[model samples]
Target: MRFVAMCSAPAPLDQAAIRVRHTLMLLALLWDADRARVDLAHELRLSRSATGNIVNELLAAGLVQEVGQREDGSVGRRATLLRLKACAAALLAVDLGASHARMDLLDLRCRTLGTRTVAHDITRGPGATYSLLAGLLEQLLLETRIDRSQIALLGIGVPGPVDHDTGCVVQPPNMPGWDSENIAAELGRLVALPVLVDNDANLGALAESRFGAHAGLSDLIYIKVATGIGAGILLGGQLHRGVRGGAGEIGHISINEQGPVGRSGNPGSLESYAAAQVVPALAAQLRATGLQTRLPDPASLQDLLTHAAHDPLARAVWETTGHHVGVAVSTVLNLFNPQAVVIGGRLALAGEVFLDAVRASAVGRTMHINAARAHIALGTLGAEVGVLGAGAMMVDHLLTPRGLPLLYSIARRAGQPVAEATPLAQDAASRAPPAVSAVYTPHPSPPRSHPYSPRRNT
Candidate 1:
């Protein structure tokens, strides 16, 4: 996900301190951990009194609720467990690809309520794309019977390099006319929600880490080999967007300095060799060399895959492409040494032929230590991975101090204000040192026991 700075207000230091504690508490509860009050206090390095104050505010705001008492067979009194109120609010997640878009309405816990996909050309520029997304969102809301006011945030994953903080897209080679466009401002006008924009590949990485077959892999790399190729990287369970958000443009990695030029003016870039769009042409070129094949001259990627089961030429082209991908992945393995590398997007559909080739090439090239630990696998989240990732990012932001205002605004519009101050919180105005530092440095969360299994709407 992208990083957004916490919004500072001209409020009293005590209030700011309380807000920080509240944000940290929410994060501790949201990470699929079954925690009690004392557990939260311990994890956040806060006093029990301060933890109770934050919990009270969250409970009043209807963002969190006590489920039941924990029963760990401890000798002491059973501590009551807390969980984020799943139905407190919902988020709108959008995945914008080079030629299609998918949207999902997700609850606070990232359960999909409604989903929709539509084919559209992203090259039409920001305005047209925004209009189309707005329409799709309207359709999704109507189908789900969700009110506009219930949507707490909008998270969109675009197929481009995004300035995560500004919500602006950089000069993405795949997305023409999207350079320096502030997608959040443009899309916010139509959706009327706080918008978060991030790279689609990064979202893929986030989704895979949280919900794919390789769920719980903190240090992972998700490579999206679609119309364009790029990578999403995670380090210590956190997204590494790098400085200026240009960290994962693997498609521009040059394999042949004198090979064909890509849109980015990079010669023999990985995209030129391994992207889904290039597969058909690669097959055609191989066929021109008098190779026997039943497929037509101008076969689509789908057609090639369908014929690949028995077509030697089709298999050859995929293997070659996979080799190119493996070359780049080898470089990734050496540098990042991630725990796993997940391959997603259209080209991943080639199945074993593609994956096996990638594995062979990558494993053969990288250091044995790095290669041995890294698991090369396919993404199980399918077409909705990007949307899921967008939703996950939104949920994460909503639990933070900066994003709490957006949720609070939604709550106010719904006529739910913060709960009245209690006797325990009467001394909130007291000037005292915070129990913990303002900076939150959370320990890496463990993998969820039950990862999300995506359900498609009938």
Candidate 2:
């Protein structure tokens, strides 16, 4: 059930063909044109001829086109190329981080058209965050002059655990008023479009895989070390959104029982010692030990981190912080044999100091095998990642297992009785498909062979 991309092009057939062409062209670019088709065929296990046939079908469907030629050092005529047209489809994206929210307009090519950010503490007063988002989105669309109907999908990336299926944010130990918020339903109603949501770390991992440092890699982990720490895990080339979507809370791993009790009541979680808030107090304690330091007054955790990088005592504080972070990350390394581990967020900005301890602790504690494939580095996406991630989250949801809005559309058709609809839905369900399957699953049992008639199968 492919979406027919709406085109502004005048020629009807050409318009549809161009839309399909653009979509496939974009995918080829993402897949790396030189190697992708071959890889795709290999992955799909289609022989050259069969693959060529499918490519022809895609061309016929207006989803793709042969654009150029590729030479694999063969003697005869080279293989023709395929690529997608980028402007045929569009998506909507939102990123809700601890400090702010950002909205973006994206095309099917994964190219960004417009973006707007509402800068405010998301953990602030009740309704402040969502209210800010409501206005921000309105202003962005207005400013960009983009039509609403052009947006076919909406994606959001929240700062904390989200029920992957429902897009609801679970109670964040740090953000007090966010629990019970029905993000999906509310946003769905606001935009009149399909809404998809996931946690920020997961989105960061997605960003890395789709468009950043870990691009083309099969197994990678994206770690963001903000006020709190988290990990975005990618296993076998896909995100592992654990049961309830709350799987990436690496900050909650208990590192010190004797340290101050953290938000979730776990004594000495990784966050307690490594979070921005705790660094200053630890620096202050270092000062009390008769060590001269510049960290005299700590207003923001970032301030302490800045001093720690230069001042000896502050460096010591970071060393300790890194140790704690390392302990927690070591556990993760042991558990996940990832190809890369990306460190991000405010804490990661501490650069080498923070990473050294994490690396030392991890290497010392983890088995050789666990640490073998892992490569630790900072995030390459920077601040834009959160928003980009938010946008990407929606795009991923729309493109993944959860297919399109066909069922909903089928339901809305006038005079289509429920009895008549059951068979259509079941037939669609029985032929399980990838990506789309993530979006919707039909009834497990056969539709009553006839909805209005007595069932004969039973």
lDDT of each: 0.74, 0.60
Weakest lDDT window of 10 consecutive positions for candidate 2: 449-458
Residue-by-residue lDDT tens digits, candidate 2, 1-53: 11111112233546445434333323433323323356546644556665566
Point to the candidate with the largest TM-score.
Answer: 1
TM-score of 1: 0.83
Give stretches of model 2 more than 4 Å off: 1-31, 34-81, 124-126, 400-458
Give the Cα RMSD of candidate 1.
Answer: 9.0
Candidate 1 Cα misplacement greater than 4 A, ranges? 1-15, 34-49, 69-80, 416-458
